[model samples]
Each structure stands twice: as structure tokens, then as C-alpha cells.
Target: MMIRSALAGLALALTFLMTAAPVSAQTVRVGIVIPQSGQFKLLGDHVRQAFEVWNAGNPGVFSDVVEGDDGCTEQSGKDAAAAMAEAGVDIVVGFLCTETLAAALPLLTAEGIPVMTLTVRADIIAEEAARLGWKFFRLAPRAGSEADIAADAIFRLWADQPFALIEDGAISGRELVEAIRIQLENRGLKPTFVDNYRPGQATQPSLMRRLKSAGVSRVFVGGERADLAVIAYEADYQSVPLKFMGGDALNAPEGENPIPEGTIAVLAAAATSGPEDQAARDAFAGHGLIAEGLRIPAYAAAEIIGAAATRMTYGETSLQDLLGQTTFSTALGPVTFEPDGERREPGFVLAILEDGSFRRLSIEDTAALAGDSN
Candidate 1:
């Protein structure tokens, strides 16, 4: 009778252990809701690579990646959010395009999942936060902020030279160009010319002629990669002496044709082979991924999730408390959020295309530039 009783107790203990094993291994799962296959696929791929690198260094922190095709559309974003919620992911870390993010915001907020967005449009983030609550945060600089950084660099470089402003009619592009113009105007320098162009139309010979006629020594262009590249190529082909300046979209990696030489691209501060950055890069390389824009932000998002999970008393985490208290020291820089979930401090670097590769240019006190609306 005693032996039989002991056997029964051992069986009960084994059953409990078996049940708890899976729960223990389920550390923290984050859903990366970005377009895996679409126009924004490149951006999505970079975000994934960055997350993988973070996961590799800190194993068991991020359990899985749930892909969602948010394709910069409202309907698609809704579908993506539904899929992520169904997967029971703890957090979500991406939305490269603004429209998609706007659509996904309410759905993710309702699910009580923290979303760290990489989209640069300020209005989308502000509107979503105002409509929702503190469920969303942005990692990238705002469109106006980025444009102002580029403008500051240009103004400093060619204070005496006449400049022209060219804008593509996208929401972000238009805002950036206007901001740049405002900054120039504040410095008592008006743009020699301002023109709007539709994205992805054949090279406008008349527009190019006007730019050349303006005789501006330097020009600031706000447009997508293809549009900007076309303008640069046309300017080069025409042998215009004008140097061009634009945003990071121009720095995007390409095959064969690239942004013409004698052009400067202002971009987010990039890592240059430090121990932390190299380790992160190596981890991604192991997975056949290359880190690019918003890549560091993705990795930082994972780290933030892990830290929040660790802080939970009973190992039962809530997105609100986790994000509210977390401060991530990422490869990019120290990341802490404001009440509205925007970065407390934003920074950018001016990079020049040197020998077919983007190289960072040193700028002092980027915070001052951030504050300088002029």
C-alpha cells in the first residue's frame, strides 16, 4: 500500500512539470507587422534583420516573428493587426508607411499591445495618439525634423550660394520641402525657385531647364527614390553645375544606377563597426540579412520588450507599464519616450555619398537643430 501511494504522488508531480514546461519556454513573443512583400518590403526586411540580430545576442528574449502584410493600405493594415492579435504576440515593432500605421493603431491599441513605429510622419503619430492613448511610440524622426536637419546642413555648407527647392507631391515630401523653405527664409535667404512635380513621370525637360536657368548653386529636393534619382540623373546628364541635397531615401541601396555623384544625403546616424554594432551586424549576417534604416530601432524595440518582461513581478507583463518605464540603450543612441510616446531627444547625421557609399559627416549639438524650427 505504501509503494502504491508513492507511485501515485510521483505521477502527479510529473504531470504538473510537463504542463509547466511549455509555459516557461514561452518567454516573450513580438509581432513584426510590416509588409513582407510589397513596395515597402525592403524596409520591412531591414526591420526583421535588426530584430533577428537583437534576438541572437540575447537568446530566448524574442521568441517568434509574426509577419503581417500592411502594404500602406487601410484594409491590409486591419488584416495584419487581426493576424497579429490572433497569434498572441506580446508586442509589435513596425509600420514603415504612415497610412498603414494609421489604420493599425486603433486595432493594436484595443488589443493592448505596445507598437513602436518606424514611420517618420509626425501627423499620423500625433493623430493616432490623440485618438487612442499611450499605446503607440515612434522611433524615427518626424518628417519636418528630418527635413530641418538636412536644411541646416545645406545652409551651413552654402550660406552665400543661391538655392532652389523641389518637392514631390507626397504628404511627407511636401511637408519636408516646406519646412526646408521656412528654415531658409528664417536665415534671410529665400529659395531662388520652388516647383512641384508628380512622382514617377518621365523626366520633365522644362522643369530641368527652369532649374538650370535659376542658376542656383545648390538645390534641395524632396521626393521618393525614383523621382529623386531621375532628377539627379537629368541634372548630371545636362552637365548642370548644381549640387543636390536630399533625405535618406536617396541613400537607399541600389543596383547599377544610384543617386548621381556630387549629391549629399542627410540620414539617421549610422553605426561604424564598434563592438556593439559589429556584434549586431554579425548576428544578422549569420541569418543572411543586412541591417539598414530603422533596423536599429527594431532591435531596440525587442530589447525594450525584454526589459519590460524582466520587470514584471509575477512574470505577467502589461504593455503600458513596460513601455512607460523602459529606457533602451540601443546602437543608435539612448532611447526614452515622452508622454506622447515620441522620443525625448531626436538626432540625425549628414552623410555624403563618397565613392559610391554613404559616409557620416560630423555635426555638433543635433538637439539644437531639433529645436531650431528656423
Candidate 2:
């Protein structure tokens, strides 16, 4: 009888251990894909640091991190993806180059792993994702989103007023201006003047003269800071009263020709501004690094990945479903992914140049300015 009781007790204990093992021993592996070597290594380092800082703050969130270097090349990306799949990571994040990411998607998808890219903003990625059925998510806005945001802001503020669309003839500027023009036209609007001006000139007096003759009171300049400065300078020189707006390039570092006061800019808001981003910013600052560039976005990616992993581990939900169905609270702000894995709303804001820096424009303030313009 004593032997029988002992055997029964041992069997009960073993059963309990077997039943609870999965719950207690579950581990989530996260794969990090970035250019670990090459010219882009500095960017990869920043991303890795971001993940480290996040992990330190939230211990035990990720059981293990598998690192793979994309090398910012097609072959390297394929190798990296294969390694991540072989390691059986739950999800892979932190791609920088479009070339690398585009090359790696097929392999990662075949392994049934989701990807959240920190910096690859090429629109083709999203389009390809839709067509190819890739499980992809993007944290950065698409490249053309700059023009879309700029055009929307202009249409809101200066649509009623006489406005002109001008470019510097560079591919970046030309594409931006052309896209803006198309967006505005689709909205049943047209520019009062349209032209391309030669960039890098000492003065834009001729451009200013033509703008004045066309009665363009507002102009969207798709060009560099120096060219815009010269345009503003010549506008003042030739007594052409014009209010200028430009894409994010307007927020570039001040050169010899400083960005004029009152110039409107559609720029990405600086990280760590509000309370939502404060903790991550503090984390970066603790490591003696500023939360900027790819750093903050990578931090935001960490937040999303951690949350998704936690949910998928406990609940009866897959990582891809969690990513697509949920709205993640990130350092950058609330991030919601669309069904197609693109960011639902791009985080671009209208700002004004004041005191050599860009200050975010409030909605009320922007509306009031538009009213004044009209």
C-alpha cells in the first residue's frame, strides 16, 4: 500500500509538470536584420542600440535576439533572411535599405515570419507586398508621402490664394513638384504659375520677377534650402510679397543662406517631444545617445514587436494578425497598420521656420493662417 501511494503521487506531480511546462518555458526569439557591416553600419549600430536600450528597460520581453547583417546588398539580404528563418525567429525587424529588404522578402515569407521595417520607405515595397502576399509592415512613411502631405497642406492653406508650383529640376525636386501638381489637380485645383528654376544660383531675381508678373502670392518650392533662401532674398529684393512653403528639405541644416522666417515646412516631428515618446527618449539619453534618425524609429519598432510577441505568446493569435489588427502605442505615436501592412496615416506635420528652427504648427493656428491668406 505504501509503494502504491508513492507511485500515484509521483505520477500526479509528473502530470502537473508536463501540463505547465509550455506556459512557464515559452521563449520568443526576435531576429534583427540590418546592415551590420559596410557604409551603413553606423545606422545599424544605432538600431541595435535602440533594441538594447528597450530590452534593458523591459527585461524578459525577448528571450533571445538573433542578429543578421543585410550588408545593404541583394545577396547579403538573402543570406540574412535565410539565417533568420533557420534560427526560427518569431518575427524579423530593422531593415534599412530597400534593395536589401526587397531581396529578402520572398525568403522570409516562405518561412512564415512577419517583418517590420524601420526605414525602407520605398512605395514599391508596399505595392509588392500587396501583390506577392508578403507579411510585411513598415514604420516609416513612403517616399511620396512627403509630396502628398505638402500638397495637402498647401491645398488647405493657399488653395484660395494665388499659388505657384516651382522645382529645382533635380529628380527629387521634380518628382515632388510633379506629384504635388497631380494631387492638386485631382482635387480640382490648379496653380497660378508653374515653372522650374535653375538651382544653386546666387540670386533668383528672374524667377521672382516671373512669379510677381504671374501674381503668385504663394509658391511651393521643390528645391534645396539655398535656392529657397535665394528665392526669398530675391523676393524681398525685388519687392515681391510672397509666402513660401517647401517639403521636408526646408528643415535641412542652415547653410550660408539661412531659411527665411515664416517659411512653412512639412517635416517629420522631432522625436521625444510629447509624453508618449519621453520614456524611449530617456532610455536613449541614458545611453548618451540622442533619439534621432533611425534610432527613434527602431525604438518604435521594438515597442511594436515586444507587444505583438507578448500577445501572440499568451493568446490564440498569430504575430501577423496581431500586427495587422492592433494599433500599437509607440514612441513615435500611435501606430496602426493597414490591412496591406502600410502605416494607416503617415506622421508628417506642418511646421514654420522660426528662430532658426522648425516649430510644429497647431491645427487651429494653421486654420487661422489659412483664413488670413484667404
Candidate 3:
């Protein structure tokens, strides 16, 4: 009877171990939602590669990747969200389009899944996330941040100087310039002149003439890179000696007119080549990939998820709670999210375009540069 009882206890212990093996060894499933079949495929491919690079370094975490075709459309977004929920993904990442994110949020929210969007930076979505209680995290800069940063930088550098505010219709230029104008005005600062300019013109000589007439030495133009290029060129052509500043739109591809040297803009630091990005850049180079555009942020998103997942597994905190409260180190430097899921650190910087590239400058540097330009 004693021998039989001991054998029975051993058998029960074996049964328990077998039952828990699969549960303990289960790997995380990460849902990648991006446009796999559309005009944005190239961009999506970049994001996908970043995840692959990240996974190569950390093998056990998120061994399975559920690819979702966002298609950059509303219906596809819904389909992707549903599929991810059905597949039981631990978290979702790589949403580049506003349409895709807007459609997926409600469904993912219902499923209690957290999402870290690499793009889709419209301010409305952030506000909606807070209002609707969606577990959404934004890794990209907010849409109106350009205006806010520009206003603050301009106020610091050119508050006492004669400066004008101008914008075009391209890329929501009106809204950005107006926001900057209002912010500066609220700070008790007013522009010397303000007007709307027609974009895509071959020559902005007339605009330059008007700016010259205003007796303003500095101008902040909320317009496209191409338009700003022309305006700056025309200013140089007319010998106006006017120093030009712009919002983040200046970071876009150069137009027929090369962006003039010494042009200042408020923009984010380059995702690659910084001290913080060295490891990521080396990893990308090893895999024959270049870190550009949406790739670095996507990589950072994966790291955030992996770290949070590990912490959640070892602690009593939920992934959502951990993400909201903890500051994670990434290739973009230290990233912290507000409870609403907006990234708080690594804000926009003041940069000067020189010899065809933008070099970030300090506020003190910007002040000195602005004074010299005038």
C-alpha cells in the first residue's frame, strides 16, 4: 500500500509538468500591420526589415510574426485587426496610414490588445485614443508639433527682430502657419508681415519683393520643401539678404531648386547616425539594410514591446500599464509615453540645412545663427 501511494504521487507530478510545458514555452505572437500590397509597399517593406533585424538579436521573444496587410484602407484595417485578434497576437505594430489606424483602434481596443503605431501622426487620432479608451501608443511625432516647435524656436531666436509669417496651401501649410502665428501671438509676439503665397511657381520674385518691402529680415514660411527652396533662391537671386525659416515640411525631398544653405527649420533629429542609433545602424548594415524613414522607429517599437513583455511576464503589471509608466531605452534614445500613449522625450530640434544636409543646432546656436543671418 505504501509503494502504491508513492507511485501515484510521482505519476501526478509528471502529469502536471507535461501540462505546463507548452504554456511556459509558448512564444509571443506579434502582429505587423502595414500596407503589404499598395503604393506604400516600399515603405512597409522598410518597416518589416527593421522587425526582422530586431528579431535576429532576440530570438526567443516574439518567435511568430502575424503579418497583416493594412492596405492603407479602412476595410483592410478592420480585416487586419480582426485577424490579429483571432490569431491572439500579444501586440500590434507598424501602422503607417491614418485610415488604417483609425479603423483598427476600436476593434483592437475591444480585444484588449495594445498597439504601437510607427506613423499615422494626425492629432485627431491621439485625442480619439484618449476619449475612446483605446490602448494606442504613438511613436511618431504629432502633426501639429511642427508648428509648436517652430513657434517656440522662433520666439527664442527672433522675438525682438522684424520677421514675417508666410504659408502656402501645400501640405496643410495654412493650418501649420496659422497655428504658429496664434502661438506666437499668445506669447505677445507679432509678425512684421503675414500672407499666403502661391506654391509650385517657377519663380517667387514677387514674393521676395513683397518681403523686402515689409522691411523684415527674417521670414517663417510654412510650406513645402520645394516652395521654400524657390522662395529662398529668389531671395538670394534678388539679393534680399533675408534669412528664411520653415517647419518640418522643409525636411522633404528637394525640388528643382535646391534647398538653400543656412536655411533653418524645426525638425526631429535623424533616426540614424546618432550616438543612440549606432547599434541599430550597425545591425542594419550587417543585414545589408539602410536605416531610414520609418525603419528606426519600427525597430524601437519592437524593442519596447519585447522589453515590456518580459517585464509583464516576471511582474504583476500588465503590458499596457508597464508601457504607460516605464521609460524604455531605444535607438531613438530614451522614449517615455504619456498615459495617453504619446511619446514625451526626444522632441523636435532646431536644424540648419548646409551643403544639402540638415545638421541639428542647439537653441543657443540657433540664436547666434539667426542674429548673424540678419
Error of 2 at 97 (Å): 1.3
lDDT for predicted candidate 3 compared with the true structure: 0.82
> Can you give the TM-score per candidate against the true fold?
0.75, 0.88, 0.89
State in Å the error of residue 57, model 1.
2.5
Question: Which residue runs does candidate 3 get wrong by more than 4 Å?
Answer: 1-27, 270-272, 370-374
- The global C-alpha lDDT for each of the candidates, from Candidate 1 onward, is 0.70, 0.84, 0.82
Q: Write the per-residue lDDT of candidate 1 for residues 311-331, one digit (tens) a residue.
A: 654445455666766776666
Best by lDDT: 2
Give the Å error, residue 250, model 1.
0.7
Could you tell me which 10 consecutive residues in candidate 1 have the lowest summed lDDT?
Answer: 365-374
TM-score of 3: 0.89
Q: lDDT tens string, model 2, 224-261? A: 98899989989888888888899877766788877678
Q: Model 1, residue 247: what's the lDDT?
A: 81
Candidate 3 deviation (Cα RMSD): 5.5
Regions of candidate 2 where Cα sits further than 4 Å from its true position:
1-27, 37-39, 269-272
